[model samples]
Target chain A: MKKNRIFNTITLLSASVIVFIVLAALLFTGIIDEYNGQLLTLAGIYIIVSLSLNLITGFTGQLSLGQAGFMSIGAYSSAIAMMNFHLPLVVSIIIGGLVTAVFGLLIGFPTLRLRGDYLAITTLGFGEIIRVIMVNLETYTGGAAGLKGIPSFSDTGDFLKDSIIKFSWVYVFVIITIVIVNNLINSSPGRAIVSIREDEIAANSMGINVSYYKIFSFTMSAFLAGIGGALYAVYFGYLNPVMFWFLTSVNFVVIVVLGGMGSITGTILAGVGFTYIQEWLRFFKDFRLVIFGLALIIVMLFWPRGLMGTNEFSIVKFVRKYIRKEHEGGSSKPSKIKGVK
Target chain B: MSVMEAKSISIVFGGLKAVTNFDLKLGKGELVGLIGPNGAGKTTVFNMLTGVYSPTSGDIVLNTSREGHNYKSIIKLKPYQITQSGVARTFQNIRLFKDLSVLDNVRIAFHFNVKYNALQGILRTTAFYNEEDEITEKARDLLKIFNLQDKEKELAKNLPYGEQRKLEITRALATNPKVLLLDEPAAGMNPQETHDLMNLISFIRNKFDLTILLIEHDMSLVMGICERIVVLDYGQTIAVGTPEQISKDPKVIKAYLGEGV
Candidate 1:
């Protein structure tokens, strides 16, 4: 059994790496093109933040409506690091995540004590407060007028190389984020977090630190959201207070809800799927929100548990089932024919 | 030799004296029963012992170790800390993590024993896998003992009613606690299941060397397995004796009924 587990792990990792290399090769070769690369990077960044939200809301069972606030903090912090201090782009991105993590801890400690709707409202208020602060801090942040002429991934001067470079950064971060989230959910600390969401009282009596795990999940989520924000800043080379609005926060939550809560694979699919759908719906111009709203309502009405319903998409399981069916085909077919006769 | 002791513990909710001057001493490897009419503070005493509710007066001193030494006042400690200090409980309503698998339920309860940090867990360090593998091995052993090994991968809520109750006990025992508090363990079982549960309780008590405090309305099972019976009435200890002595006590009769009989 242990050998099988090790084999499965190796296969999964190698498969993911191979797929990444193939895609990166395509991007570098210019076959994916700049426009499609931009779209994929956007989808990748959104997945990072959605995974962050999933860590808190889906796994930890805490409703947080202030994720966009953390994202904005990352965006501004990383932008300042790169433009002002001339720090390396990597360091600046990390700085964004670290600074935003501090804020996550600050807000999480006070707000995590509240549960359900109260926590949601507190987070919503916190996001608005961050946006307000960004709008007011005109000198440091460039305020509501927006920060422009920021350093982007176009350092190589060659358009093809630059697009690949930026896409690689996003893709690498996406893989890193996925690994961290996946590993965290399958471990002991992850079990503790989920148990808190299951039954706080039962979790407590069973010797799980409910509050500490809640804060831990919250902080991890904030860090990831910050990373997503940093990626956004470098990708667009521009920022505005209007960009990280309440509606932006709602978009991520909608993806999480459309995916199954607590299903990591489901959230990734929904994040990437919803991003493309939104981009396509841009033809509707200003009424895109109406379309999104209707889509959400219809989805919830049809499948309230979301796409996966807490069941993960496992390639190994599907392949095994398919193989077993093929092996049983001869005997099963004869039995079915005999019964029919 | 008492693993857990409550010295004149009392708790009040608003103006009502929910449980007044209650006391209990659970000896090593002994099974005790707490019985009372509905709302007679049986569960309130449980709440006080488990650190769910702070006693308005008195102290709850737990041994805090497996060797029946290192007694400490657990009254001021948080519920999780008290649990770590060697007490574990199962809820009356069977609070299993419904969405999680049966094996996952037991493994989660074993979380207190996990020594790896979050970074190690995320990194999949050797130490993390070692501890996690140990937990899985132990959890499987526990489920096998409860005869639910076949359904370990099934969601907890999908289990039959009797098995769900068994799974709850299985989860509590996974903590490897010195003291186990069962809140109405036999609340919703048939005679056969309750009989099996009675045997299971006694079997585990001996196997784990555990001191048990069970609150139950099942008279036969309680009288059959418990070494001592503590009867409560209106937030007070009305009687404390063997099953034979408790059955013949007039105060207990008065509490269970109205008057002359």
Candidate 2:
């Protein structure tokens, strides 16, 4: 057990160092231009979006399509805070998440009682309703024209004010999002949440408050999506109802399904990969969406469990087995497979 | 005082009486059995006791302090709330969380006992780590009691039939119930497994000081372990007495082996 703990620490340290090195390289060497940097930041935001959705739809087995609604709430709230209240970027982002969480609580209470496709349709309706509200509320949200001139992280009187956009800000938020989510997934409440998905009757018999956990998961998912929205507002320096249409929620659902539901690493990888693919498919012009639809269908047909299914890829277990084999005088045979029984 | 009591509890489904005027009293540390023929509402009785279906007319009360309080009626409570109030039951058909690990099947029952909250979990506070580690160790220990320690990492669905039943009982025990309800626990088990299950049931009754109410089709296993038995036929109690008296009762014999047995 002690050896395993040590191995976990080593694996975590190595992974952190690798991410730091890559980000530092990108910053120091001008290998990535402004467009690439913007895409990377978008990828980071989607990582937050996908991971949060995974907690609700994947782990808890509650199919939701209202993510864009929560994101719009966050984006608009953060933008309003900055434009009207003149709050710091960080404070406004936090406010955005909290405001969206409140909305999640209100929507989740009434609609979470529905199951499966009914729940999905209800959330989709909620998403469209939020968009309509944003479009019609011209006085506060800048109407159908949308809100503009939202300040970026670099515009917050920071050291790197000369840079067009700060990649580090998004990177740090991505890291924080990952840590918070990974921690929740491995905790006691997380076990109850997953058990509800596996078997609700059994979960109830075992003393799990199913309704409470369902609401909790939905609320948390909205909270994170709100933060993602805040990031989007700052990244683009603008917001519009059309930008958060019902199709936007469908896009997030596609990313989550194609990435493999319930696997954080898979969602992160799929978020980045799908963003890049969309950018690359821009050459197709009018045929872009057709190709995108075909790609989704093909991936679903070939890989129904998505990229990772329900299994997690654990670096610590991989490192531990390798170290053990080397210590025992390594043979040509492979170390035992880990993370799956 | 009886650990659990049901008085005149009845449930009707659209004018069809599924169960009617059911009554039971389970004493502390006693192992009781409920036996009936197919479709005799044995499982329905268990369901009502556990708050699965609220009795349409009558009351169900729990006398034990399993929830750190004394004597309360659980008829209005939800199923999970009933479990929290010290009544835990296994299903007639095994309802294990099929995709979860065997250890997780037991660990999830211990969820209410864990001291940490969501904020602490997300923050990874010291209290969160301590409680999680403690619960994991406790779950392993509980598995050891059922001799399922070796299968801890196996998914619940992958376990063999007998082991799955044992795991179900182990999970029910994990809830630390004042009364443990077993619904057809020895069903589909071979003679050898049935015999082992009987001994295991008696052992846990003594070890955990549990008031056990089991619904079983196996007469010998029921007669062997249960001090008293309640016979049901057409959703009504035909007789309630010690095993010897119940076996000789005419109604019970008619209910089981027809008139001549």
Query: Least lDDT summed over 10 consecutive residues: which range in candidate 1 chain B?
Result: B62-71
TM-score of chain B of 1: 0.97
Q: Candidate 2, residues A1-341: lDDT per residue as tens digits?
A: 33444455466667766776685576556576656767887998988888889988888988999899999999999999999999999999999999999998888786547999999999999999999999999988997998988987775554333233467777778877877777787788988999988989999999999999999988898999999999999988889999999888988998899888888878887899989999999999979999999999999999999988877776655654676655533432111111210
Which regions in candidate 1 have their CA more than 4 angstroms from the true location? A25-33, A316-341
Could you tell me every candidate's TM-score relative to the true structure? 0.94, 0.93
- Model 1 chain A: weakest 10-residue lDDT segment is A332-341
Give the per-residue lDDT digits (tens) of candidate 1, residues B1-261.
889999998888999998888888889888999999999998888888888999999998988667748889998988989888888888888899999989889989889889999999888778876787788889989999999999988999999999998999899898888999999998889999899999999899888889999999999999999989999989999999999999999999999987977
C-alpha lDDT (0 to 100) for residue A198 of candidate 2: 91
The TM-score leader among the candidates is: 1
Which whole-number lDDT from 0 to 100 does residue A130 have in model 2? 96
As a whole number from 0 to 100, the lDDT of residue A251 in candidate 2 is 85
Local error of candidate 1 at A235, Å? 0.7
Steric overlap count per candidate: 0, 0
Return the TM-score for candidate 2, rounded to 2 decimals. 0.93
lDDT of 2 by residue, B64-171 (tens): 564343778899999999898788899878999998899889989999988999889887677876787788888999999999999998999999999999999999
lDDT of 1 at B258: 72
